[model samples]
Target: MDDESWALSPNARKPLPELIEDKIRALITNGTFRAGDRLPTEPELAQKMAVARSSLRTALQRLQLQGVVEVMRGRGWYVRSTDVAERDEPLRFDRRVSDSDLLEVRIALETTAASLAALRASQGELDDIAKLAKLHQAASVNDKDELLRTDEDFHAAVVRASHNELLDQLYRSLVPQLRSYRRNSYSSAEVHVRSANDHNQVSWFLRRRDEAGARAAMTTHLLGLYNDLAAQTGMPVEERAGLTNYALEDEPSWQQNR
Candidate 1:
């Protein structure tokens, strides 16, 4: 907002408040307003848009309610990296990253990616995802390495099906950390059950083209993983009741369609 050259369009026929909200949403989606980036002060943005501060605040409040941005009292508003509120210390960029932090990033990335994939994936893409899930499900858990590799492949296929190049690149960059988590997760039998059930459910959701269900499946999968990792390290695991409902229904699409 502060001299950032984000001036609102002057010719819009829509309501001023709505126009302001659209502009902000566009800026955030286009990467101009990044996670944790403080917005321009109310006066500055109002001047830039040539709108009253009251209208601007209304637009911002709408964004806030939508979880697109957050307002910090006495400090100002900032864009959220994820749909949920961010931690006081956002994930760091340095190499000293924790496993829990990497899992957080994975949840944020994969959940949205799955939602988009359910809506946009081609039939062939869904086939690829189903094939990968089958491979993971059929693999021998005793061969931990193979099981883990197939699990990673299934997740990679899901990410590819999302068709978001930037998100794909970011997911690829997190491979090392993901591999670390996978290695630890494979040691537990419960983890294998969680992965198989969740991956199968994910593939089923994709075939059904259920965006919300797909996102929920991926979130549940990763949260299960987070729990597995936490238990291994003796940390308290998160409650799982909310996002853990779906499973591979009898004769899921993957099996019926195959």
Candidate 2:
């Protein structure tokens, strides 16, 4: 226990490292500290969060262990970018800005490709998707990371089984972006649970080779991420195109806003 550990809401039941980890995790998960952004120095963070310097160090070390941040020699610790843990570590952000633009195009392609996949997926592909969805539905707090990775793998698997070499190539090439989106999408347990249910429904329909079912399931599920936001804020779906508004209300981070 440390001086400020007693001040956190989760209580001292969680260790200092875990408390610090929670804070850092909240920042990344809430989009407060995005990729490529530098983390505050140890002392600065310790002061800002009212945590003991030693406790903060422990937290940073734990984050490093999780491959969520790094300590550069002679420099300072920085939040690890990218959705994936270590395997996706080396993916630098120096790539062209077209990557973000291409993401919109990829989303359209992927959404349709998943629909086509519902029509043509093999027994094995269908089985895997169903299995992953089930696991996600049954997942608990302790299994969040596992469920998240399995969910991504299942989606990527669908893209791969679509039988279009060009589509597969394009999708595989976009894994980095996909990973980032996945991370950004699941900042709350409510969202994760909703997505898991939708995935399970999609998987069930795809298994039946119902093209309409699969397409509708996928489109509805994916669009829900933004549609829910728009609806919550009373914004028309079409009007959302040119707006920068997130339109999400009572988000988890808002509770932390000073």
Candidate 3:
């Protein structure tokens, strides 16, 4: 719970660019800079942050690739969007998710939520869903973290309204892992905006008592997600599969395929 806590490395820490990129990204997401705002001049920023210009430049360049910034002809780099970090998470790079596997995970939860939300959601719960959806549209510093949390809660409210205490309890328990995996897989504003739209639709239909629509909407949304992940097959991992070079005797060859 300590504000200063961080996971320490046992060996050489990650490269300077990666560390700088992470911190800068957190700042951008936290709204230290707004979209279209210019960043500090490279040399001045490097001096102020006590970092090498090379490292800072590398960090800025990485952000540029994610559409987080742009280098103008006469002007320096400017923030393109803060939600870029959501798209830049591990999902795309952490070995592509299989569409089939992703679908199964989604079907297991969202489908059930749809059915339950149609019958049991309270008026107050419906209002809460709307509030969360509105909050998610905000990306300012005070609202950014709340935006993420609210988005998660919007889906969770569906489970609660479903009126199945067991289902609700199960979802509540799995929420953290589900959220982490979902974010880890596709944590970008692109997905975030889509999810917000989906949440609103699901909530709308459920409020209308459109049972089939609610179920169908949630299931369809999840299926589309699975398909998107599937399209990313063969995304490259950073490390090479050279385990054989360090393999101990008696190790099986099957592990080398990675």
Candidate 4:
């Protein structure tokens, strides 16, 4: 297909750069652009998409950061090879990612992801997130395996909806530790109820595009989990906070809620 075929009508609700990125991602995913295929020049892409050159460049830069494409100094961008883009080697975890550390990082990273997802996620992505959350909530307390998988899917979907490939990559690399933490935290029916409430709040904020609300919901959810683990394991608040660089505000609402 010719570059002109890529022309995109401007969206009043979405940024031009985002629209450009979505189109390019669709092209790559659909096999219209194979690995190692050189993309049209920046000017050509901009003209073809009917977007400003700056917007086109921004979209390309974002894709490059995600390892979706490689930019050759003067040559142009090329689709990244599958072997390189989706390597077989597993990401190595720091030998020391304790439960505390995992929760700490989850609070920091997931809250930000939720915030961005509120701003960037499409309706379809939001639907997927809500569906997973509902599935997790509806699973029988005895059905541990299904509950765990559904919970993971809900969180993973939120990260993907953030539209930041680097964040998605980082979260995925921590899956092993995350799974362990979820297993430890989901022991009580009360905890499950609390989690369902938190996830519902998260989905609500995301649907409304309320960034702060989404961030707060995610933070509250993870902090609640952390507090639960700390209580169950008899770990000190200070020690847990030290693992992920969080401060213990004595009697914080998140901790007090339980």
Candidate 4 residue pairs in clash (backbone atoms < 3 Å)? none
lDDT of 3 by residue, 1-258 (tens): 122322222235688777767766766776777887888789866765567887887677556544567555346878867876354642332565544454555466667777777777888777766666666655433444444455565666567667785565455444433444455544566776786777778777877988767876776666556545545555343321212212454221213233
Candidate 1 least-lDDT 10 residues: 249-258
Cand. 4 TM to true fold: 0.61
What does the lDDT read for residue 30 in candidate 2?
65
Best by lDDT: 4
Off by over 4 Å in 1: 1-92, 236-258
lDDT of 2 by residue, 158-181 (tens): 675576756755555555554545
Clashes of 2: 0
- In angstroms, the error of model 4 at 167 is 0.5
Selected candidate, larger TM-score, 1 vs 2? 1
lDDT of 3: 0.61
Q: Each candidate's lDDT (Cα)?
A: 0.72, 0.62, 0.61, 0.74
Candidate 4 or 1, higher lDDT: 4
Q: List the lowest-lDDT window of 10 residues for candidate 4.
A: 249-258
List, residue by residue over 1-258, the lDDT tens digit for candidate 4.
876558665688988877887788878777888889999898878777777887887677556544567654447788874333363233666586677777777777888899999999999888878876787889788766566656776787788889997787777666655666686677878878888888889999999999877987888888878777788789865555522223553112322221
